[model samples]
Target: MKTFLLNSALLALTLSLSAVGGPTASPALAAEPTPAAPVAVPTVDVDPALWVVKDADTTIYLFGTVHILKPGMGWFDEAVKTAFDKSDRLVLEMVEPGAGEAQQLFAKYGLDQNGKTLSSKMTEDEKALFTKAMEKVGLPAAAFEPFDPWAAAVTMQVMGLQKGGYDVSSGVETQLTAAAKATKKPILGVETMESQLAIFDTLSQETQVKFLVEASKVVDDMNSSMDAMVALWAKPDPDGLARVMNEGLTDPKLYSALLTNRNANWAAWINEQMKKPGTTFMAVGAGHLSGTTSVPKLLTAYGIDAERVAY
Candidate 1:
């Protein structure tokens, strides 16, 4: 079977990068415990997208987010703010753990203690590609010696972007989370940290390495690809965003794990959230809201009346 680039998909689709810090770890994903350095507030404003699902008593606002961005986007205002301000609670893909806890969790599943190296799973050709990628991100070959392929893939993909100046602190969810905390509004997550890790861990080793190789191939294009995706997102063009993000999603289990099944679960969760009387602001990665397997598309099957909120 052919492999697709799932590393970018993991960043684009799941927004699952956690605190995997070390001198060698990707800066954007490393150091989750540390408070983010203050961002240079951008004067250039942008209108990303959002949707509204409602009935007489319950209203849920669904927004798509980019998990990392270059440090100059002014996104958390206009319609996005109105919806969030009116919301009773904020729902995210997952609530991240703090400090050593997130690092411990990532290492627990992503590392090999018995000294099985990540490159040992690859062919000579694949190893050559992976080695070059590690070097491109300014990490040594031995830095990933203990990495599982998925972990290496995660590190390489995000590190490539971070090296290009994308900061996790500048991501959509990061700022929203900070604001939500300041206001003391309740925040909830659709998945747990352990469960998100298991999605990658349970993949067949072959699949994991396949994606790792995919990461190696695309690491050079990371900035350009993300620039295009973010451009589409700023236009609030879900179709264009879908076209870019969902491209090369050929691996069946990866497609299911990263988008389809998770989206279905989210739709089901949104449907259930409608049972009680309250407003919810549901924010997830743009990939989850823009595709055919998007939460809005699935919500339609459940007879949940979801409409584009014209801002």
Candidate 2:
């Protein structure tokens, strides 16, 4: 359940929320911005895991990323940068929508116009838990009344991240997308933003409410888990990352919808890309590139092997 954002690609929504406005998009995160870190911090060289799939002419680099981070993470230097610089094209999980479009999409799918308020979906105990967490973040009990459960859940997580000083502008995708645009590199998406939103929109109400309840339990301090996840990623230990991110992701149906199915789709996409002749750097959430149902493992079933790129 916790892996939904880590593995299911809902992390993109956090960035989308920021793009539409700022963290203040949710009243929970309406605090003054923290001062930027000093410019002369020591660089901590991190070798995040990278892999490659190559044939005679085509080379595809598969790099895993933490969606958001505190600024000053010196991860873009080493082999990760070299692979990105050498690539002719950049492929991301989805090409994010612009601010106006994202705002419209959220209104269309994230709002609960036809249903009772998100709090109504909760049991008395559940509502108590969620309301308590909301109060902790200085949000009124009805602050999330207009949102669907999925939206409420995502907003809680995003607001927590903002409060913890995780900058969306420092996110790996944001950085890479800007660089790709600057160099005139053709940026592509394996899926569309609409399709990604549809995944959450199509979820069963039970699952949506369940996800919301889980999110509320730790809403005020969401970064503790992420800090641990980033530490593992900075160590370049994909196996360790899998252990942390994939933990408690046990529901079979949600598991398939979140991880295995998307990985299979990405493998098929890569197989088709192999038919062409160009270097492509594919960056996605680290959770997707780790775990037993990782993209590389699925690629193997398609007879394409992804080897680790030694730094």
Candidate 3:
């Protein structure tokens, strides 16, 4: 369940929450601000051969994906499709078509057993900060009281991104899912919706407060962050990826709970999948594929190597 919320929140922040905007409109909306051209970060060099792992007769192409995208931003390079075409199945963190189930699960886990609002669970300072952030995103202060702070932060970020012109319809996952359907390839989910939500359920109230406060500070820069994510994703640099992720590590507990721990678990599942007999295309957030504790590195711990396919 941690995987789901983390993935969803990441998607919400990086991609956009407007899942119904469709592909055509998203690029246009994402283009509205006309972001300054990104300053080039030094590219990390990795072995291209190591990026493609092959066993006996089966192959698994690990494509790090960005959940949100901008107009004319070309993320799906030719090599990506070549890798996809070779795969017999498509695998993702969650296979559900839309965010509806995620929304419901968030509402459920956000509520207290005693029927009290989650805002009641926060410190006075935390509540004040949360309220200000909610207002900035145009949400009523009371609307988020029932849920945990982390959940509220994620929701606020999603809403803020939408206002900033990021839309989920422009996401790589959504595009891949559509393409998979068009090609008649089978799509499988690594985890269930309930399990995904369960991760959020385990967070302590204190961790949740920290998450909300930190998220609030960066709400305005979400669009820039999205652009930065797209730029870094294009480079596929593991070290660069780690540096981007580290920027969000203000809350140590939430950082591990939301990113590191979940990456370990996803890496385990990915390792198991690699042992199977058919080619599979695994599309997950680019952030999950980098870092010392990333899925690719974790796979190495289990003796299953994930090679990054060049674009």
Candidate 4:
């Protein structure tokens, strides 16, 4: 479940709660924002890739995104800015939430209102480790009792990223959102918060418990996991991103639900959108734009051509 949540395209940003740090449009608990370390690399050296799918009347730009990044990554270059300037609409995985929606999501799905607590699924040592991890992140153990294993897993990952100095405020989605708002372009969501959360919400109890146990065991390693992923992301290597995204995603059904199925759906949406007569700027997690089930590849299966745009 940790792999599923951490590699979850753009779902991480959408579901983050307050405990994980900052108000997310998605679900998470709360924590105060800590200062981030200075970016080790200059932005001028980074040139993230982009792609475009167009017909005579309509065009769609697909830009993959990282939901948490160190500041001054220099990813917003002229090519990206030019695409955004010509786009008539902006599309994301889902609409980022307003002030109180993340809290509502927590109450709705993350709470233990039914009396099932996270501790119930852990062994003695696991419980101790979980407690220690919670304290390490400055969250009280009881504060996470209400969370289901999947939610707890996501929270742990988010906390790990925060601790490692990744900043959601500097993420691509946040910047593009601000830009779209500033330019008065209409914003569209391909899926709803409920639909996205339902992916984990619908997992079997056995799987959920397994996820919790595995997450507890590796709570301290989340930084290294994210660091590896960020390294691949910084390279802008689609094949490497696909490989990293697929790491530990061994369960076929789980992979389908998390990546394959969703990618197919998004590809279909892009296909349908192509029949319309306007340009759209679409940004999703980089993972979704890579791999065999990527939006571009899946679109090819349906006979649409999506060409990679050079930096």
Candidate 5:
């Protein structure tokens, strides 16, 4: 159970990363014109209505997917596949083939000062806590010395999940991308790799430390985290999402910056695509489709209605 929870915490982080949109753009860009405020998009009050969206000619199955999965977990339910089969194109946060570039972007945002390893930057107590956390997950303290705290946390979580049997190779996006490729379906991305990485780069140093501390706590109760995530994904209850947002998300400002702001941006992009001709089956993290601040709710603000489809 401990192993399962640890894997789930890792998986949850993966889902959040994939869905939240990576780091923000670099600070060197020219200032653009400010856009008008978004109108309040009316949300359809419904349960289990988070993932699917439809219209007359096109249907986008908004799957909230786990990026790592235990064998035979059955994340790809029949309804999800049926939606994929009916579409002309498949869209992901970032396609796997382009993942290398994404990693490069991530490296750029990470701390790179000489003689300033993440471990060295930590206070004595934080260093001790981080060391214990890593040991609990079967990792060496020095293994994370070269990276920033946020980057190190992400790495430790992914490595722990891999050790606990949640294989990324068996993830929903992996299978879906394969199927899309086999069928010659057009694949697309909601945002650029640089744009996603930029979000992390924009975080203040203090915020990064807070993220690391919260992540350490999460590692301690891996199974409960996994069970909570599984229950949420199995049925995207708004209340469940709210609870996770309230409880699981330790940094309120970071959560808003990472999740809510990006959801609005993605929602704006998705709305534009809806105006175009072809049918697209969009698969993003399930978390992006839930809660009051979700993509679907944002779409409502744009006057594009997204209805939930039955499985």
Candidate 6:
């Protein structure tokens, strides 16, 4: 049963990454000729996906973002650049975690100095697995000693992705933020950093332990899962991605808290943004755009139209 739980964790985490998002509808938009390159970069032909919500004056491009990717994957093509270039502002789930922002936040919520250490909370077999997993990713055992289970889970998720060849520099969020900065456009966050972090921080300890245990199991098999994610995203298969993510998570409460609730909140925000007049580009995790509880669906429920752009 212990080994079974350990193995099940990887599949759940994989699903979690691909677990947010809604369906697609379309009107064709003409693609202008792509401009000359600023510098020579390796190119890969993959079209992820994008959606647009517009009224008379306001046009917001909704994009799904993979937080990490292997270096040299060329996803910033003409269609994406066109939408991004036309937008006046860039919106993300949270502001960029630069200048020790993450560390400061972790110090406040992640530390469990008065409570049991992470190892003490784990079973003997689980502790061994956790230590081995950390070491495999070059994280010292002591590094996670003070962390809450949720924090440890999140940390391990990143480490697993990194070990699988996904580079943070190549992630959609990083690229878009850099472009927004270089172009001097304002960057807005849909939610505060604190609110985003609090999603996990506020979870019950049993749930947090479940999350952490599952995360520990993914170290060896994350690559295959990531590959499936990239393929689904590259195909821009919102419906397929939704099915993979929404069905994989067995716990309704966790799914609701992590993906469903957030999508509804974002949909509500989008409805408000539509009332104002401006072209804003909003990029969030792809999973939030699919399934029945996705942002697009929620927006549709509110009688707002979110059209997928045909590339």
Please state the error at residue 97 of candidate 3 in Å.
Answer: 5.8
Residue 203 lDDT in candidate 2: 83
**What local lDDT score does residue 53 receive in model 3, on the 0 to 100 scale?**
59
User: Candidate 3, clashing residue pairs?
Assistant: 1-195, 1-196, 2-199, 15-68, 51-307, 51-308
**Looking at model 6, which ten-residue stretch has the lowest summed lDDT?**
21-30
Q: RMSD in angstroms, all models? A: 4.1, 2.8, 6.9, 3.6, 11.6, 11.1
lDDT of 3 by residue, 1-311 (tens): 11123464445422332343313312322333433544444433322111455689678777776565444445554677777787898888777634555445544664554566767777788777778877777766675555566656666766676667555666677888888999999998776656655676787867666677767766666667766655666655667756776766656675686678878888777667656778888777667777777777777788877665544
Q: How close is candidate 3 to the true structure, as a TM-score?
A: 0.80
- After superposition, which runs of candidate 6 have C-alpha atoms over 4 Å from their true positions? 1-41
Give lDDT tens digits, candidate 1, residues 1-311.
Answer: 11123322244322333433442333434433444566565556778888999999999999988878777788788899999999989998888765455556666677765668877889999999988978887666666777788877876766567667777768887888899999999989898776777788889888888878887887778778878888888887999888876675667888898789889999999999899999999998888888788999999998986789887
In angstroms, the error of model 4 at 200 is: 1.2
All candidates: TM-score: 0.88, 0.90, 0.80, 0.87, 0.79, 0.83
Per residue, candidate 2 scores C-alpha lDDT tens digits across 170-218 of 7788899999999999999998767777777878889888877877876
Query: In model 2, which runs have C-alpha deviations exceeding 4 angstroms?
Result: 1-41
Which rank order by TM-score, best down to worst?
Answer: 2, 1, 4, 6, 3, 5
Deviation (Å) of 62 in candidate 6: 0.6
Off by over 4 Å in 3: 1-6, 9-50, 97-104
Which regions in candidate 1 have their CA more than 4 angstroms from the true location?
A: 1-42
Candidates 1 and 5 compared by lDDT, better number: 1
Best by lDDT: 2
1-311 per-residue lDDT for model 6 (tens digits): 01111111122232222222100100000111222333446777888888998888999999987777777777788688899999999998877543244445545666674767888888888888888877776566555667788766655666556556665667788799899999999998887656766676788778877777766776666566667767788887988877766644656667877778888899989888888999998998888888788888889887888888889
TM-score of 2: 0.90
| Consecutive 10-residue window with the lowest summed lDDT within model 2 | 23-32
lDDT of 4 by residue, 144-184 (tens): 66677777767776666777777777778889988999989
* Candidate that scores best on TM-score: 2
